[model samples]
Target: MKYKWKPVLAAMLASFCLFSSPLTALATDNTVSTIEDEMVHNTEGAAEAGSAETQTGESETPVQADEEPGWPSGPSIVAESGIVMEVSTGTILYSKNMHAQYYPASITKIMTALLAMENCELDEQVTVPHEAVYMEDKGSHIALDEGEVLSVEDCLYGMMLASANDAAYALAIHIGGTIEKFAEMMNERARELGCEDSNFVNPHGLPDERHVSSAYDMALITREALKHEIFRTVSKTVYYEIQPTDKQPDLIPMSNHHKMICSGKYHYDGVFAGKTGYTVVAKNTLVTCAARNDMELICVTMKTEGRQVYVDTATLFDFCFDNFKKVDIGSSGTEGEEIEVSVKEGDSPEKTEKIPFRISEDGYVVLPSQAEFSDLKPLLLLNADRGPEVTGAVLEYLLGTRTVGQAVIALPESMIVKPEPETVQNETESEPEQEKEKEGKGFRWWYIPLGILGALAAAGAGFLIVRRQIWKYRWRKNRKRRRSGRH
Candidate 1:
């Protein structure tokens, strides 16, 4: 009977556990998930509130294992030296032997144009120097006669549009006083622009052993040049007409050698402009641009084995647009539930303002869904003032992550921010006065008490010392007297 009852009791307890266990598990799971979501929300709040802009790569998630590379043609274009970079962010999307040194050939003109545009005034008159009219017997030439006068602007069009060595030489002399000096300036500018493995023997990229540049360095130069509006307008010119001069009266008809400039085969629309170059040694160097769906890509290929430079550039552009996209990092266009940050204001008595950030509008380079923001850091560009009508504050922002391209954070325009009534504002006009009053009261009350206590302690210590001395003196006198009596 006892064994049978034991079995019955065990069975009853098992049935009870089975009935209650599911409910208990469901509640625990829900609570854990809520806590997790709350944590994620708080962290993301820092990110959305623009405070996270101060944070760096540590807070970002790891990229997926099977994530797609940024460029669509990343795997397709195989050249001795190549790179595909985002136009706005200057982020490298794809690369191969990019840092390897190779003759830049005419692409050296890109830097030449950059220097010339800033230094030589467009309206300044230039006379062809004898030294520029004649260079080492090799390389392309526009054959300018010595002492011929032309506007500095015409010479620029000639150097860039015709890829003429003579124009490049003339421009260098006009700006630097000599070709050798100009070359020094070019090398100096290269160092300033962070081109570590570059040297310029001449202003125009003729195949001098000293006139060599790495694909990476050329890309860096081009990236900087693209910042100038003149370069974009000049490099992409389909036809340029140099004014007729006394020496050569025929209006020089200049055409861009970049095949994409005229060829309808490649779909390059935003290719506002780019330079082309080639030499037997350099082997078909090409740089070009294109836009698709509002994203512009700059492709650079140097030292290729064939003359298919335009085709390769097009392929690279297509690969990037087809594969990658720009993602806004902050509150600009984030998907799912909206993330917002609440700021307490002081000067302006306005209440809390909700700022939402999204992904698309923030200008971040995003790969396919497989890719995640890896090693991301937020850059906050903020402005503040100590006076009313605060000078136009710019909340400029920037974000960088490994897998995603760098994102530009657009700042809010200058506007007054006010504090919510419920929230405490640290900007109390009476703060100093209140602190002074408290300090004065503390001195009158607790400080007086402490001072009295300290004085008593000192007096007590002095009394103990005096009592010990008196007892010692009395004991000595008594001993002396006793010794005297004994004697």
Candidate 2:
């Protein structure tokens, strides 16, 4: 069934870049350092497509390769963990080791960006803190001097585009008054977004064992963050120049670390924004967006082998866009069969029946060929003579073994019986002959009086009938006398 979502996508992909060798390997490659050069080289073609298509030969890269080629032959590709998701539906197309824990590294900035947009006004000016500037021990840095003041918007670009640890810390401190407090907010937001295996130690996603999240959790976080218009815009930006502040005379050039933004091969037609991360441990992690024929998809890859992560994620996207389709899987407006139900204690014993109805429309569900229809369970809330009265009965519809939608079945209100005095009496045992004699005394005394009244009424009615007959006869006799007199 086609469900119209209220502008919401699930939190499905996110990553972090800690400075660990394993984690750093994914981010330090040619993709990260040469982003500016690539963007300039492909700016002409990319501009025509409005940032949807990346540079040449890099569009819609899949997260991981399948066990065998030619088709999506296996479960969603995975090195350490990965996910292929439909962007518009937030439905996971493929996943492997998606729930496995890995450092989110810079991908943690996705949450930072989300929290900043939610908590702080974009116009709010923040003073860069000494602590934010001094996180040199952590790998990523924007090199913001202490006491520099910048707007929340500029810091956002720095955090998202440059993967700046300083910008993340500064934004965290500005919004929450402390990095620890901001970290708490991130964790709380993660939990609220249903990131079951995610935790946060720092806003910048530096190397801290405490800062860990699974691919599934990362996807969940990404899905949640992408709903915000601000986050979507910021994450996709290839380059932005932060205006000069009072202390800083030069404009800081912020650039997107994700190559999919500039690579022509994997650039989708509709991908607005996404995030990327790397650490030696997390290894070449990427979360990307793509659009085709108005359908958008998000793919995540972590711990992938060499350059294939991009290719795998792209393949997953193509498979999803090409195979399954969105369809309205709901019932028709007109009522279907009116099922007859028995009602007890009806006025007419033979007419103890009520009608309930089910309505369905023609539509199909979008799923892989291997998918099957889930069992349909009748949600009948019929009013029986038992417990509490079942007032509103309905049958919810199911899709793929889940209650994706519901259809209401109206029960006849008048069909329900209220317990009468005789019904209550039937439940109690009757007394024996002595009690019967006691009952007979009061009934016997009133019976004669009631019988006399009934006889009087009947006699009165008989007299009225005789009087009417006599009146008619008198009228006919008068008419005869008048005729004789006239003769």
Candidate 3:
């Protein structure tokens, strides 16, 4: 009976494994398939929503989702691509497929606006070209006529507030000579702004498969754009009334599509500037900057369904603002402690000298609000090959794998002594003696002069003794000769 029970138990265990193995595999496959489906569905839904909104010229209010647990313990977001970064430190606080490239849609105007501000003055007049007004019928526009006249300032407002496609083209052509060249400039500027996965095919983000940018890249562009006063002013404007232009003579009332900035539907108190973008292919994209308690943050969300773009961005901001605090990692000179570096071939190679370095700029690290100086682990990495005279970033302070801040480890101007020209060796010295002399302790400066003086003294003494001997020989010879003469 015991043997029969053992067999039965073994048979049951085998049956369980046989059934469970396929079930486990099926569950994993379903999970992956579901994620893929969700991403595709989100993209398709965003495209439909954007198209519907553009057709109706109506902005949708964002529906807020239930708040999850605080960051690091929160539920996953629905955005296909998103990122939250510190404006000052460029430290990434939260990211989901941040580097994955997505179409930027109308957010492309940010770069166009940036180039306009840089290349044209606010008062500069620009003529709307035929190409500017000839966009697809379905695209957003402020109804600029061909050859219409507007100031650069007005164009920016029209483009940003209303996401006007014609205004963007006019500004681009005016600043960059042609749409092609303007796109080139946009790409160059994107590279300069540290955007890696981005390409600009046109000034207005219409759907070109070639025009793409990543969430991180868009954030980088937004960061640079925020630096300009005009950009900030234009982006934050809710309703800008464009004065009647020469072609139409009717005043166009433009409203910002960014509900966060215009309608204040999902507005957070600290939101200063935001840009909204949408396209059938690119889906929905958004970039916003917010500041709280002196910590500025930039958030970008892409390929989200309906109002989820706004909801996702708001959630990211909330998570970051609630959980993270800007900690002054302290500036380079604040510590007042100089780093002692062993400089090879330095003036005092035997003894290390203290290099006074200041953090290139005041650095701030974003950490959990509860994080303290004790929790921060700083590693000082010195460039062993760096010259003593070169004053630049010599050591970087890192927290874990991330570089929290960098200290410009520069040798003081006074300490940067041109290494004494290597003592050129006299070719006359033997190799062994040269090696001995190189040891520095082997010979003093007085040794050569002392040796010369010793040789001169010895020669003089020898000359004097030889002269005395010659005189003695001459005297003896004269005496012998005189005695011989007497005999």
Candidate 4:
């Protein structure tokens, strides 16, 4: 009984399903997408807003000799090596001899403060070594006696605010185990931040001929340092007091030497953090970080005169902040959809393989206020062309010669379009099949149409025969009536 009813139940269920409304999950649209659309938006929200102002490999607008708008030359100052870099994008806004090597003076403490914060806890106590107590202290010092102890937080505040060499050395020794080992750690860190032309032999920026760095290198270090919460807090501080320690009694008052942060005559509106340095040989060196209009700027000036370093930094910051604005590339046209570029097929030109990619919305280029998005150039780095900086970035955006930002392009291996293999047939071996195909073409389905026409004709003939028979019968009856009348 169950077997017999199963088929009937199945048939009824099938009928219900066939007549029911369609599922809502199958909806879709067919709008054409741009290159920005070719790359699918990743979960990290990496996509441009909508930059239709680009060609396949270049900017949309053509640049000519006379019409090309170059990057602005910031106000000139006495600093021999100076640079203004945007923190987020790592864009070099205004640069003059930025690569030249110069003594970094006391600004080298920034690295020491950063490493201490990273390696030790804020409340962790750091012991002052015997060397810190009696070591050459002609430079700035908080006068730490031997066996004196301070927390990592206190040391950072003292090192950054007072530009204390003793505090820097103590933190370095505590973190790296020795001053020489700490210097090695510093060099290693500098290399990690892409500082190509820098070497550190001491924690303090004392005039070691070998201990030297470039403006570019220092800015790079500063950018890396600002990532730490403690570094950021200490760098911007104007004044801090070190309370009585176990080895010392009186309070140690410390004040920041940075004119901008100290509210000196050279104070600028957005200057939050800075480190000042001066040695007879190095002259005056300064590193400043400022923020305005949602953008952070790091200005490094090496080998400048007394007050001119402050003047140079402020000028450069004002120039960059006033003239430049950030613009997104490969932004959101339609999110989650990829724009594909079909460049090549394996070995044959006949077929093509399209690779799907998306430009990271996180990537942006700083452009001049008057410059249009079309003026920015996009360089897509594929396979072998990718470098360390572009490891996760598929595109590098440039404003003239300077790199403004990079695009986080997602190129999934699963999404690669490969050419389908072709199946070839030998003409001789398939001759019989070819002949059969030819014969089959000739054998058209004429029977269906002809049979339909023949059935219709037969029906019409039958109707005519019946009508004739009826008419004959009627004629005979009429003749009989006439005969009867004549009789």
Which numbered prediction scores highest in lDDT against the true structure?
Answer: 3
The pairs that clash in candidate 3 are 332-359
TM-scores for every candidate against the unseen true structure: 0.58, 0.59, 0.65, 0.65
lDDT, candidates in the order shown: 0.65, 0.64, 0.73, 0.72
The regions of model 2 sitting more than 4 angstroms off are: 1-78, 87-89, 330-366, 369-487
- The residue ranges of model 3 lying beyond 4 angstroms of the native Cα positions read 1-75, 331-334, 338-360, 374-396, 407-487
* Model 3 TM-score, 2 decimals: 0.65
Ranking by lDDT: 3, 4, 1, 2
Each prediction's RMSD over C-alphas, in Å, is: 31.4, 25.4, 23.1, 34.7
Which 10-residue window of candidate 4 scores lowest in summed lDDT?
29-38
Candidate 4 per-residue lDDT, tens place, 1-487, comes to: 4569888999999987776634322221111111100111111122132222221213332221112348665665567788888988898887777787888877788778767767889999889998887874336678887889999898888788777778888888899998889999999888888998888988878778998999899999999888886687888888799999667898999877777877656788888787877665786789999999878899998875456566667778888899998766655352355543333223434322344556544666777888876555555444433432233335566567667777766655653333333323454558889899999878568988999999999999999999999999999999999999999
The digit string of per-residue lDDT tens for model 2 on 156-253 reads: 89877777778888888888888778888888999888888888988876667788887777777777777888887887788899888789888888
Could you tell me the lDDT of residue 477 within candidate 1? 97
| Model 1: per-residue Cα lDDT over 18-41, one tens digit each | 999999999866543322111212
Q: What would the TM-score be for candidate 2 when compared with the true structure?
A: 0.59
